[model samples]
Target chain A: MNEVKKLPLQEAANCLTPALRLAVDRLPEQTARAAEELRLRVGQPPALSYGGQETALQTAAVTAADLREIVARAARDSVHSYADSLRQGFLTLSGGHRIGICGTAKVENGNFEGVRQFGALNIRIAKPVFGCARGVYEQCCRGEPSSLVVLSPPGRGKTTLLRDLIRCAAASGARVGVADERGELAALRDGAPQFDLGGPADVLELCGKQDAVMHLIKTMSPRIVALDEITSAKDAAAVGYAANCGVEIFATAHALGLEDFRRRTVYRPLLSIFQYAVEIALEEGERICRVHPLKEGAPC
Target chain B: MLKLLGAILIIGASGALGLSARQGLRMRIAAIDSFLKALSRIESEITYRLTPCDELIALLAGENDPYAAPVFQDMAERLTHNDGLSLSYKWSRALREAGPACGLREEELGILCDAGSFLGRYDSEQQRHSLRLTAARLSAVRDEAAEDLKTKGGLYRACGLTLGILAVIVLL
Candidate 1:
């Protein structure tokens, strides 16, 4: 490897891979049966829907030997310490759960920046809650073009809703391409997905959301592309680009109430392309829903 | 009779001295053993990180595509961060040996010896296999850190005990 590429940032990822991969491989097999049993036999609180999934227990096996290997690996790369990994980002094995991530800040444009340094990752040990998204499928997909914008005040079932809706759309013969950026939406069962998303609806996971969206649009010509969170302007632009191509979009966002969603319309740089903009926002604990006929000069 | 009594006293004294020396040797051995175990484990991890990078390089080189060369930036960070404790153990061992060879062979042992930015450059992966490498790296880190702490803790105690026993023998 060249010197520039063989840099600190490069080594950082190299240092983290082994543990995560082992966890990924073992997580499914190990946690599959136990986590399934736990989700079923565990508490069924009304507020909490047991997505019937297991927690990853890989970190549970993180012995002293594993740690030493990490240190040793770092040491080999000329790194004197490991604490600095947190300043950037670190894959937290949340007791065998794997959450891979990039650093909080980089020397980008010869400057350092990002949100309050997000160096910790939570690998949401994904479980196939067979009926997890069944609750929100209809709400997300009931439209002519099905231009949905699922909103939740964080920690809500937006992704699950999106996942189920993809299945719903696919089942209905709509070609869906899910930009599963974090392996959350489709929760790839082993190598394949549990949900029968028709005719290999391409799931561009781990690939950047915007890039994946663009790729799917150009190549697949998907009838529907289920995007997770429309956070960045780039993502908005991609969605808008996809919509311009005449393909419907099934997307989600983060918002509190209808008014908040209305406010978010300003962020609808790309959202204006969709003829129908169905906003599903959460107010208090309940979801106060609305389906808007989006047109030219309308409140996006 | 007096000569016999003197011999017996001397024998008793020698026996006590021998026991103390044996105890001291045991302590030192324990210390060295713990230190070596930590060092060896940390050493093993260098191979862990390098293997994937090499494999990634090998795979990409054959294809003549940089993009195709997989990356594991996240995993490298996890391995280096939690596993930095191994440094102190290695340092401790070096102190005992009082030599450069004992300290660290940077070329021979691929330990990114400086804990400064252990997790430097694992950006992302092009394939699923790289993810598996990431999994292994994280595990090595978690295991090493916990092990280092336990071993170092025990080793330190042993060193102190050995010194204390030596001091007692010398003073008394």
Candidate 2:
């Protein structure tokens, strides 16, 4: 990989608050470059996810105040704007790094209002492996414009692969609209994507997934609509609507395997919508485990 | 000639001290007003942009007067580097650090420091409520400062001149 396309380790470290930034900066260059996530908890030592292994930072133990400061920095000190994300248990920073927060849940009117007294924080670094989806793209989008869903367990390269596939489709002059619900897909800043999402891609960052899919269909006239991590029945229904409207769809989901995917009732409707389900496994390296084709009129 | 020169030196020194005392009082009032203006800006920012406190403070520090700017600017920088200090603690520290530069009295600065206890610790609605309360209390303090500047401000200058004149007569 060219140096410019390498993981932005230095910029990521600079984004952290000073104390944590110092700890990350002190890491060996190779470790820093390979680092994937920075996990911190109240009254516990900080840890880094390096090459999929958790390594503890040999610094002072994190305190409640430390967690608050990190939140302040991540939210840019405006917790109000991030309240929705806080209720959803994560906030995506400007560079598309997602910070998962766990704390005392504050519920109001049968819905999560926000979090308070934060207990833990997980900073998931954004690593876009360029051209990793060449196999998946070639396999799924062979003849006709078809809908595909990439599936994997959490921390796998589902998002990474989906992004590359979108780029591939866009490179072939397909108009793709990305529903970047958490800004992780496009990592847009100042109305421009921080990551290269091919040439003919339009992104809507931080909007609701279902709404974005519908909006993309109506306004952007995109040939394909892409979403990240469909988690709800509503999102599945939206994908079905987009598919019926003659717009191709691409999405990612967290599941172990086909059996596990079938067990989840929320994604039942989606099974009929997608032509192929590409399961990514990280056994030896990131490779396609299975590309299962759902039979016509499959059980929902 | 020697006696006259000595008298002139003492009188001049005392008169200058008195003038500065009056000027200090006026400056104290001006500083308080500037602080109120800064708080108003913060309220607007919270209500409208919901900008992050650190970025908001840095922006205010750049736009506000030097006397009032340091508090917000210093807090923004310090919030990032504090060795895990709580928000309230950092807010108090910033007020104290900028107290001398702003020329605000301990009691006056205390009003601001007290508001720091609730800053960024609650929901947006609650934060807005707290800021409004703090701004109201600051308005009261500004009124008191203005009263002091009008009443005792002249008294200090007159006392200094009178004392200087009395000392000169005794020496002569």
Candidate 3:
């Protein structure tokens, strides 16, 4: 597979207010490229997060208007259209960058209406490191598709790995079905995926993960099914059912390692479904993927 | 023969002036009616489809309202090819520029500018509320314009003809 190009940080900065955008632009080219997330809070200077550290942009404190402008721009001046996603506290931009919102919740009878009086925004820039999954793919999915789970605590490139793995699987003549619940993995626009997930892959975007999994399994008849962040019992049940039907699963979970993953009661049921787990860690700003075999009934 | 020609010219010019005044009133009424229709369509789109401001403006531009359609088209073009400006700015600017040609009064234009401020800055319910309020105000303005056309239209025509006849009689 050809190398996938990295999206520039300026693409994410375009969503910021003019002042914040200028502050980010003033950063050194290397720092801007290495940046992962842009953080904005009301009455605070904007900051950039990279290498598990945050560097504040020295400028005027972010105002309520600045935050609102970011939200307005991110929604493309259509706040009503993104009401559902805003209620869930995030809006996915065109290039797959996710903007996490913080504000007063407008709840009606215990149901979330949406957000109001915006407070802060975390714009997580999506840097799709295309070949980052090479080591995991070679170890876990060489000859035949394998059911493997990517383990990481947050921001350790779990989603990035799953995206590349899906691409790798699809390139190898396998029909891969992606359950992109948050519209993050595929970032589909006009029926075309923004991120290259290979030609043979089919994406079901903006649907719940469990329904997407079952729906893909039933309709697409995919050889491999991929999902990001399996966080619920329903999702585990769906993954288990898909595995039972002889379809390989590639998924990610929030865990430090296999032992930490096994300790979580909610994800205990999923352990039996995955044959191997890949744990991602950052050492001196370089990502290291450690693949471990999960023998059923193996001691923790 | 020269006196006859002069009298005819006086009457004809006065009559034309009356007709022009009546036409201006009619045009105002028509412009108000078109704006009312456009506002109603906007409310429906917001309440039901939750269409984005740019897309909604583009849709309105495609409509056949002679007065409002051009303004909507200008706003749509600006929105489509945005240059990092806010929607409120684009919206107000478009209306301020094209609104006079639509025969909209300053008060009516003010209402439209106010509506632009909140066009896409809130959720569906808030947006619909703002649209409905703008429509209500425009509707009142339209009713007044229609009443003016009804009451003063024939009076202007008659006064113009009477003035022309008086001028001819004095000349003779």
Candidate whose TM-score is highest: 3
List, residue by residue over A1-300, the lDDT tens digit for candidate 1: 665532212222333336533443443433333331111111121011123333433243433334334433432433222223322333222121223333245555875422122333322333333444444455444544356677666656676566666776776677888886655565453256544455647887556777898888878878888888878777788787777778778887777744576676555564456544545555674644455655564333
User: How much native contact recovery, as a fraction, does model 2 achieve?
Assistant: 0.39
Colliding pairs, model 2: none
- Candidate 2 per-residue lDDT over residues A1-300, each given as its tens digit: 666643555555544657877887788878878888889888888998876689999998998877877786566556765665676778766666778888898877988767777898888877778888877777777744578888899877888888998999998789999998877788765476878899989998778887888888889999999999989888787788888889989888899977788889999888778888888877766465567776574222
Model 3 Cα lDDT, one tens digit per residue, A219-299: 999999999998888878878888988999999999988889999988998877888899998788778998888866432
What is the docking quality class of candidate 1?
incorrect
Query: How well docked is model 2, in DockQ terms?
Result: 0.35
Each prediction's Cα lDDT score?
0.46, 0.79, 0.85
lDDT of 1 at A1: 69
Q: What is the lDDT of residue A117 in candidate 1?
A: 28
Highest lDDT scorer: 3
DockQ of each: 0.03, 0.35, 0.79
Summed over model 1, clashes come to: 86
Q: Where does the lowest 10-residue lDDT sum fall in candidate 1 chain A? A: A39-48
Model 2 chain A: ten consecutive residues of lowest lDDT: A6-15
Query: What does DockQ come to for candidate 1?
Result: 0.03
Task: State the lDDT at A277 in candidate 1.
Answer: 50
Q: Supply the TM-score for candidate 1.
A: 0.43
The estimated TM-scores of all candidates read: 0.43, 0.81, 0.92
